[model samples]
Target: MSHLPAVTLNNGVAIPQVGFGVFQIPDAETQATVSTALEIGYRSIDTAAVYGNETGVGRAVAASGLLRDELFVTTKLWITDLGRTSARDALHASLDRLALDRVDLYLIHWPAPATDAYLEAWQGLEELYAEGLTRAIGVSNFLPEHLDRVVALGGTVPAVNQIELHPALRNRETAAAGAAHGVATEAWSPLAQGGALLAEAPVVAAARAHGVTPAQVVLRWHLQQGHIVIPKSATPSRIAANLDVFGFELTAAESAAIDALDRDGRIGPHPATFHG
Candidate 1:
């Protein structure tokens, strides 16, 4: 293949390796950002009901004139919608908002392990998966303890587990658990916010050698490690750069050089501590 290769999920679903993520994208800007992304060869579009941009995302994707089957759209259920009935309703509502028959993948926005309802909520996910409302079901920000409960409830092994992953905070232990359980790890923040990683001597050298931007080198590192990454950008230039990671390969040493940057730096909220 000339570009990034999709990884087969536990259920044999082929998820695009490099997808566009719309986490902090505002509802007003989603259409333009997504339209730009689709025009740049991005087939996978990731959004969440919690992101409040689902409607805009759907609008842009629908307006793109791409066949629904040709595009892979993924969304998540908010923690508030964690009950069986609520989760099921959330699935349909998400579909309606996204203007799709069924999402390629659906995920629980967060485990919210503190609640008494996660196990109760899982049944809803299972039901939706069975009904094909969601092509696959998974959880995000779930730790090993949470995964144990999910398995104990006789829940379907998640096809994917979206988590905060970057050069820092690699989540090595969690990655092993996911692999042992046949769940794939998807990186939400593959690029750290700080310019530090891109400015590092090693990364700069690698980018120079490949004649690409530092961001491409960082994304290239994520790919070589067998991690699925969704790096987001609204600017046309960065959006195009994020998608141009297919042509080059990173050497083992180059990959390791980036790996050395891992210091367990976590920039986002810890799911365990998040109140919502």
Candidate 2:
């Protein structure tokens, strides 16, 4: 089993640097997929209420035979449920589905600024954190302004800011903002969905030089930079391969080469404009 390194959050909670993500995996298939990931040594699992797979994640955890403390489970509150009372209820509903008393981490799925309710949601997350419903609280798909707003509220600083980050879309500004506020930056699409990015010159050169796949090379880039990355794949071979990134180290020139590939290529919704 690969013993992955962990990044300590500002709140003193430790999260595995590399984790398994079930973004688009259907609820019915989530159990077997997550089960495979667990069997292959992935201790961190990232899902969301909108994914409709918390039940499956719960089932996988229940059946994995691993101790409760042995795994790190993360789920998010959707935009539609963005208020103090609504967020609390949503978390309880999620807890029931996850079959656990408390989650390792809980994130606001999106800012949904137009709704003008994320602030209330953040406050609610603060309360949940205090109530021990979640060990830590954070946000996802949040931009610099959004992060600033949360910090300005003057409660608990968010422990993390999960974002759509990859070689093609480095998102340096938002990441810098999170860093400025002591929030850990977690990369969601760390591989850019495995299309043209894997075929890029720098990624390919790194792969050939290291005798590893392009995906592994890209994952190493994120890891070497200290970003928390979650790369998901339904294929068992790929799932196992993604966790095998801890074996190699990227040199300075190679890392910079991949860094230059950033062209503001964003594959997901823009955090600033996305209402959900």
Candidate 3:
């Protein structure tokens, strides 16, 4: 029973069980934070063009002296760059900023339902993927309708869907849909950005039983549910703690107990009406 198993992608690529997220790390601090993560056995690092820290992330990787193939790097094409030409250019720019020859994964940041350009944007991703510039491509914050259209129209079925999720907001439909379509479930904001749930009775009880922090309990739940989680923390201790979840395993009763915590509690914006 391996705790950290490799999740095979639709294209047969293997991603680590957990990765570090760089959602809000300031540009200047991104390097130090990512360097700390890498040094702590984090082989995968997730970034996006909107994050404004590709340069710092790239610098951290360069300084780490790790082989390029040993790392799993992901970056997204911003919503503003959804068109064909602009999206292609954005990929190149991200590669330049990260100083990587190619990204392991790329995603369309959002469907941007108002414009309905995700189809074309996804086409751009397919072109990039076929050219070997991107190992796999997917979407983030996409609804079922968006996924249906993308898959029906010859677009890639998305290797992963990084959505706003945590114990309090599980997005069951999306997860089920992902499984139905051979897409992996990826939970972003695994901590709900540090929500009150961490102190709630159920999580606290489970944490006390396991002798781990509530945050660790919640992250462990995500892993047990077969999700690829990217938990972010600016502090090195928190970052390290988020990764120290492998030693404990949650039982069926505990898993259901935490699943009961879901009360439609979504920390991020609703994807249905989100503008970007």
Candidate 4:
């Protein structure tokens, strides 16, 4: 059985704290990689329509031989599908691609404020949740301003706000805002796209001190902070190593050391102006 801990959403659905992400994995490699993750005890899997690998993800899930309820699959609505009618239709298409009747979580991929349609798109998500197309609904890459507007616009308070978060890019304000509104914060790019961030002094030191890999140290830091993290890897050893993080602990000073590494070090697009 998977030993990963679970966090309950506002809507009462429990999601695994650590998940596998399929952001840039090629469509050809997605099925095998995702199957590896599932075998390694990852219950949550994060993907998106724009990633162009939903079909591969579906194939892997179909072949896993696990029950439908055993997995928590999450996908997003791309910027192009931001209207009530289009967003609703897009979800049906994503469901078709995923080969599932309903997804565990479906989110507005980006605020795409330039289009001025996220609010309308959120309405679409509400309709999807009510119609039972998804078990839970949320948003991604949303800042406080965007989240506040969603709350003010009035509907189901988003159950989650997936954002770009890592030790080098703490994003405390957005995380705090989500907490203020009872929205669970999920971390994407949780390891800062790997490589450079993992080799940093603090991360390396923590790994040495804890007898773990630098990636595990970083992921453990995210877990200790109560943020859901989805770290992706195609290598079998790395994928298995990422899940071996639950056995250790970091002290308050050690956690703070990593937290202090935030240098506005966001490697992804900024939420305020990124429309795509």
Residue pair clashes in candidate 4: none
lDDT of 2 at 155: 93
> lDDT ranking from best to worst?
2, 4, 3, 1
Worst 10 residues of 2 by lDDT: 1-10
lDDT for every model? 0.87, 0.94, 0.89, 0.92
What TM-score would every model get versus the actual structure?
Answer: 0.96, 0.98, 0.97, 0.98
lDDT of 2 by residue, 139-202 (tens): 9999999999999998999999999999999999999999999999999999997489999999
Estimate candidate 2's RMSD in Å: 1.1
Summed backbone clashes in each candidate are: 0, 0, 0, 0
Query: How many clashing pairs in candidate 4?
Result: 0
Off by over 4 Å in 3: 1-4
Tell me the tens digit of each residue's lDDT in model 3 across 48-123: 9999999999999999998988899999988889987788999999999999989999998888888778788888
Q: Pick the candidate with the highest TM-score.
A: 2
Candidate 4 yields a Cα-based lDDT of 0.92
Better of 2 and 4 by TM-score: 2
Task: Give lDDT tens digits, candidate 1, residues 1-276.
Answer: 124479889998788899999989999999999999999889899999999999999999989998877788899989899889999899899889888889999988888877857777788899989988888888888887787788788659888889998887788888888888998999998888878767888789999999999999999888888888899998999999998998999998988888888898998888777748
Compared with the true structure, what per-residue lDDT tens digits does model 4 show for residues 1-276? 346698899999999998999989999999999999998888889999999999999999999999988999999999999999999899999989989999999999999887669999998899999999999999999999999999998789999999999988899999999999999999999999648888888888989998999999999999999999898989999999988898999988888888888899989999889987
